[model samples]
Target: MNQNKSGPGTSLVGWNIKSWLSASVNTLDDADLELVYCGSDVPSSQCLSLVKESIPAWQSRAVNFDEGDFFVLSGQQKPVVIMRAKSPTEAQKRDAGLLAPSAYGQARDLVGRAVSEVRKFKSQKVNLRFESCQDREILGALVGLELAAYSYKQSVAAQPAPFPALGLSVKAELKDEAQAIAMGTNIARHLVNSPPNLLYPQSFANAVVELFANVPGLSIDVWDEARLQKENMGLILGVGGGSENRPCMVHLRYRPEGKSEAPLALVGKGITFDCGGLDIKDPAGMRLMKKDMGGAAAAVGTLYWMTQSQFARPLDVYIPLAENAISGKSYRPGDILRAKNGMTVEIHNTDAEGRLVLADAMAVAGSQSGSDKPAAIMVVATLTGAIKIGLGSDVAGFFSTDEALGQVISKRSQEWGDLMWRMPLFDGYRSRLDTNVADINHCATGSYGGAITAALFLTEFAKGYPFSHMDIYAWTDGERGALREAGGSGQAVQCLAGVLQSFGL
Candidate 1:
């Protein structure tokens, strides 16, 4: 299955992330427009003054300005946005509150609306003004503004219009890390939005190599079909049998100058285009299948930030990339495939291919940790629609065997505004994967608990380690405040990065 590798020659030609967007700190007086936050208890006079009396009477009512509400004032020379924030007493309670999961979520949504409003005027520069807000809150607002500014126009013909260059007006102390997180998210969005024709398995691997070419303490190795066969990755090879592009297992290692401890293992599911193999999907269902690799996009995007920030500990990232196309060689349902971990799986449905590829990747990640046994193993994937049905598209669902590790991940997700809900490992659901033949079935016979079954399947490979599986919908059907728009949302980038930093990694 030797195919011509068509992409840049060892250099990051199309992957250069520098020219995408830029952010800077400046004073409020020099800004082209202004954005302000008002608490729920703010006086009627203050609310009226913030919008410059341009809004209609009904729109300008004090009661209308509640937490997370947004209003625009366009009559003035410079447009101003007044967003309602938590009341002072509520803020104080949340600062020391035992349970306030919505604290950062409200801040993120409020800033997202402001970014959307600013974009309407095509203003390149913005002034963010919030009275008595903590530095962490400011950081969250900056992250939202930077991420909302992303627009992908790489394939336009004559000339697609360019997004207005974005600049931020804030104190100098709020410039660095916030910009890094935004840049990382934008990278994920760009990769996810790339055409599947240009971003095949091998091309995607090459892009990673080029993107991190000169990055210190970073090394990348890509295992092609031949090497995969030698290593007993039958599930990976079988799932990729229909495509000439072939599948590849990409390993990214990040070891800083003085770090020698075993790194945290992160695995991502990277199905470039999932046509469902012999069990082909409907034309409508297959439209956005190109985004199947979103899990891998988020993993690499998080690595980009970790390496750039020189995270304290090392990390190992494994991405199993392939295209599930249609051909005579396509794998069929009822076909039994053996994974690298020596587990035999009966394929109940060819469409359930993401877990197959991830099975081999997870085994590889687990083995790579050697005897140290990684502190935690986390896998991210767009693996199930059941999760969307259960949690909706706004939040990702995660499953973890370790309660302490799960709590840490949950808290960090809320703090970063990533919105992750912890689904149970539910050992009771383990028997749902029973099969008449082979060690287990690839998927459950019925649609119930698809998300849980998928996580249960993956857990078999993550032996002797604390594991967490994240099922995310990386594509947003529509805008949610300012944090995400109608395209690739880069769902788990911030959450994973926040988790790593929380572990002091």
Candidate 2:
């Protein structure tokens, strides 16, 4: 839990990133391993000429190498890895609007897989150089390397012997930006991977405080049970009443000097554990409930990135922390609760508790007045399984009240390699949430279009502000490409960072 340490006993802190300008491989510093990426457009002979001494077998094989193919040569002064990556086609480059399209995703995946392979050979210190790559591609490659190097063994009983201090030297720029984004992603991953017992509401709030204790121009405020009661946040209290840990809210504001633009508001659902409340879930359904707070982790990561990068605009982050456990005090189906906005909601199903907590946080986010009013509001949560069924586990589905804002977010998501598709906020399904007993129902009457209905439920609290909601899976079922493990995917941090950059100005 100590944020400063780096080793197997703790989460992977970060890498020692060094910048290099020399393109020649022979001029590179000596390391245990060297990774070189060869683009499809580059000739095999041109790549082979970079190395002073070459293995005949590797050179022969490189001639026929296909995209995604790689070869390794060991037993020399230092091991050398050669990976073949495809460059963007003319049409792809034209669509991207970059003179030199980065092929950011392809570079990221290739570098990540190459790093994973070399690590198996016990190579710690590594050097990377790319052929025919621009700064964007280099940024992607650096992010990929940083992500692949992450090793989380916090729960291991006997910590494995620490490897030599891992370091990476790349012949590129953007070290600061790449490191900031990657570290933000790893921070989110670490928080999501933590067990529930160690990360309840109070502990989660404390961790956020500790993490941002030294951040300049940032102020953090936490609301305890008394403050929740004073503010009449009955929806949050109702969802967290079953647990002894109690529920709370954390608000973070980052306002740098000479910045008078409206602040961007971010809201995240911080359900530390979701056991489905009184309705309860089957064992299989409850196994990975600890990751229910993945949205909060993403929000935390985004804030960290924005502050570290010194973004031009002010920002506000609201996190509602709670646990939906089973106990005598747990809120049950058909219960009526009042939100911070004074809207009555009838809970039709206890399993749908994520929306209950997020609604109150969104209400607070949209309540800012005067010059302090938020320019826009964005909410992220793992609120419904219907999203997973509709978009699958790999893609996140989003809904927005403003069309222009939604289009910009969609475009940014594609550029950042965070796949997000826009879902319709069908007014036809709004009727499903109507109930005779209350102003509205927290959940829809039936299962069809559940994700749309969930988005509708939160829209009622948006206060007419430009609002966007992202429903993400947040957990990767298996390792693939840049995702080195089957754990927290860190789904929306990068995309949200892009969103802020697009609108924060």
Candidate 3:
């Protein structure tokens, strides 16, 4: 975007990154901000603090925040969390046909609408306004940018040249911390957008380890197909049987301090490309199956975010990456298979393999991640077609027995303008997944509640944990919307990061 007081774009920037972070830092002012383009080599802090500061400093005094150009996240305060500034005036003008007063309110309206669009898979490039407002406005919009970047792309090299990178003028706090978060998110964008052919199970685990090598107190363990078999992850082994490339279960542990009271476990479904096994999809249906592992990508994003920042609590994340391909060895329908959970699932549909592999990972985390009773295990995935039909691509479907926990996730997502809809885990839905010959069917009994049935299948595996499942259609588009882009978007990363930062969990 030109800086001619009235331009139509966004700019991003970065610092020496290392220099900005080396010194013990706290507090940031407007002077610390930089101006670069998104997707540029620019760097920023990996924590929430950096994202907070960038909003107001870049808007040139038009947008404001709750306190200053940036403010510390309320409820749980460790350091200051800067916000992006947004201009309701500029926003309304850009919206042209909008009907709202106050730039912030208009901002709320526009960004929210764009978020809805992105969720629906209607738009890809999400553009929001950030002005000289204190800081919240711009920060919030930037957060939206992060959310928009979550969709899986074939590869970063194939993606648009790059987004304009912007800098946050900070008061005193080390700006690199904030930029680090951006850097991490940007890297996540690259990882998720990569094609399945290049980013297989082991390679994907390698990427995770490589990304966080700099962070202290983080460890990663990757189990190849051999180890998984020996360890009794038959479900995972069975699903990966058809692939020429062996499957892998990657474990990343982030231990901050003292024994965790309730260390959270994040389980992501990493089906790099879902061929639907024997139950193959048509041409259009399988077009974007490469992004099947979006759930695992989000998990990777979350782990990286927490690692980059110094936060309390223990965090353990599991990513099960595999290509659910068809092969001679692929488990055939009607084949009764045993899992790490000791339960046998009669293969009703090989296409419904995400929940199968995820079951093993959840069990591994159950034995690991350090939680006895129930840990806050958030499982993310582009799970079912039913989700697309029920919530569409615009809204991520959330299923959790713990209403409070689900509410927190939803609220933070809403704040960032990521659309999330909570669906009921009605017991009646389970009947749809009942299998005549097996303990339970891999898929729902009928197409009537596809999304719910998938969630229901996952529930059986997550029974031991306080699990919250997000059935993201991973597609976007629909009626009168906010954003208008149609490509791989990096969505939901911000909301997850925001919630983690806000709750300091």
Which candidate tops TM-score? 2
Model 1 spans > 4 angstroms off: 1-25, 28-30, 38-64, 86-103, 154-173, 369-373
Per-residue lDDT tens digits of candidate 3, residues 130-198?
Answer: 333434443333333333333333222334323322233333222333333444444444455567778
TM-score of each: 0.87, 0.88, 0.70
Give all candidate RMSDs, comma-separated.
5.5, 4.7, 11.9
Q: 260-351 in candidate 2: lDDT tens per residue? A: 98998999889999999888899999999999999999998888777656354788999999999888899989889999999999999998
Encode model 1's per-residue lDDT on 131-189: one tens digit a residue: 55566767777676666655565322235445444444556545556666767777777
Model 3, total clashes: 102
Residue range with the least summed lDDT across 10 consecutive positions in model 1: 1-10
What RMSD value applies to candidate 3? 11.9
> lDDT for every model?
0.76, 0.78, 0.58
Candidate 3: which stretches are off by over 4 Å? 1-132, 141-168, 171-181, 310-312, 369-374, 475-485, 502-505
Evaluated against the true structure, the overall lDDT of model 3 is: 0.58
Ranking by lDDT: 2, 1, 3
